[model samples]
Target: MTVGFVGAGRIGEPMVERLLAAGHQVHVYARRADVLERLVAAGAKPVDEVRELATCDVVVSCLYSDAQVLEVLPAIVAELDGLLISHTTGRPGTLQRLGHAAIVEAPFSGTADAVRAGRLTVYLAGEPEQVATARWIISSYAGPVVATGGRGTAMRVKLINNLLLAAITQATLRGLAAGRAMGIDESVLLEALAVSSGGSTAARQMDARGGSENYLAAITPFLRKDLVACRDAAAEVGVDLSDLLAAAYDGPMNLGV
Candidate 1:
């Protein structure tokens, strides 16, 4: 398939690389020349403008935020007749608001490393035909393609997943802090947590970072972005998340002992 790619940031780059490796003709566009350099060298064509990608069979967006996606959507919508698979983790109603029939929500889970390793899980939601149209492109980089049904369903699932992720990470950090205050070695505490019911991907990440502070420093900004999106989505549906919001904001600072 001929694919157009936008936003070659950390995660985006790997996805594009995977598509290229899978024998797709990927045309990429980004403001940063440095981000595009490696991909261009690896046989992907570099387009100077977003509209140049109109000829592609599919255009995949992995932008950092909804704002960026919205900003780029007008240009993409004006030119492309093919499918738009958004990998941005944004609010539930975003893809619908774009007002394009060809657009589909395909929020993904996993880090850049996971993408390169082809271990990323994809949550897909759209009309049956649209979902079917995007499956080939999405499957190129992601592991299992989970169809959640309807445009916003996948985004809601991704947001909820991130909300639980934030809670788990915060809880793990607090547990480590409490263990340290009681004179338990951090490694030993992590080992016990690993063997106990408290074990989680977040706990494993904290162990990899050697503590809470480093992990928080590395991921807080991204986590905060997702948490804010989740809170807004919750508010739209009359759900209150005050306690979760407070804990998520406070945990990184106070719980990183």
Candidate 2:
């Protein structure tokens, strides 16, 4: 399949490489031309604007947030006639708003390492036929393409996954901080925690290396976005997430998870 990508930041760049390796004719559009020079050399035709993705069989977006996705959809749907895959997580409503396009949500799970290793799992959501087409395109890089549900289901699932990720990462940070305060060897606490329910993919990652509290600050913005989405989703369904919201807000401030 001939694939085109919008956004060429951290995740986008690696995904472009994966698609290229799978022998797809890939094209990419980025606001910053310099950032994508290597991709251009690697056979990815780079375009200055999003509208240039008109000729692709599938156009994928790895945008930062829901609003950004909305901002770009007009260009995508107007110019491209094929499936539009949203690689951004937590933006179901945005997909539904793109009229006429066969929109699919295929959010990436796992780290950049997973992307590079082609071990990523993408949650596919859309009309059944479009989703099957997306699954075929996604198989070039991702391991399993599970159909989560139709329309916005993938985004909601992604938000829930982020909630757990934020909670666990915060908890892991506090555990390390507590160990640090008491002068206990970080490795000992990490090893012990890995044997308990507190252990997670994030916790094990931190344990594998001596972890620090400072790392949480770097990821604060991403976690904040997750909190906002979670709160909004809960409100939409008349569910209360006051405690979880409070915890999410307090986690970084208190250095407690």
Candidate 3:
């Protein structure tokens, strides 16, 4: 299959590599010329414009935000008769506004390392047929592509997952702080939590980064992005997330406001 890809940035770059490695003919486009150089060098054809991607069998969008998708993808998607797999994590309202027939919201959860290792989790939501068609392309890089029902449903799931991660990550931090106040060694507490009932993915991730400070610093920017997106999404639905947001923002790691 000939695949077209956009926003080939940090996370997207590895995915493009995985696709090309899987023997798909890949067409690449990025606002940054340097971003495409490595991809082109790895055998992807460089597409000069987003609209040009409309001709490919399938196009994957790895854009960073709802604003970028709204600004860059709609016109190109409007021209597409094939499927558009959107990996951008954004609000469902964006999809409703565009109302395209071919888009499959496939917001993902994982780092670039996870993508390179084929361990990324991609959530798929769109027309059933469109989603069924997306599995092959997505499987080149992501392991479990969860089919989440309708077009906007995946975004909601992604946002909800982000919120849970934020809350849990900060809760881990708060727990460590409480341990320290009681004169317990952080490592000892973390090691115990690793095998204890109170342990979580966030705690494991923190351990992987060597400690809380390093892990928080590394993921702060992404946490900021997801939290803001979650806030906006909740506000749109008239749902109050103050308690959740407060728990999320209660620590140093929860950088999103």
Show model 3 residue runs off by greater than 4 Å: 183-188, 254-256
- What C-alpha RMSD separates each model from the true structure? 2.5, 2.6, 2.0
Ranking by lDDT: 3, 1, 2
Best by TM-score: 1
lDDT measured at residue 136 in model 1 versus the true structure, 0 to 100? 75
Which pairs of residues clash in candidate 3, taking residues 3 or more apart in a chain or in different chains?
none
Candidate 1 lDDT over residue span 154-244, tens digit each: 9989888887878788778788889889999878887777667878887776677776566677777677788878888999999887876
| Model 3, span 71-132: residue lDDT tens | 98876777887888889887787866776778788999888989999989999998888898
In every candidate, how many clashes are there? Answer: 0, 0, 0
Candidate 2's error at 152, in angstroms? Answer: 0.9
Task: Give Cα-based local distance difference scores for all models.
Answer: 0.82, 0.76, 0.86
> How well is each residue in 163-239 modelled by candidate 2, as lDDT tens digits?
77777776777777888899988778878876888678666666655554444444556667766777787788888
- Which pairs clash (backbone N, Cα, C closer than 3 Å) in model 2? none
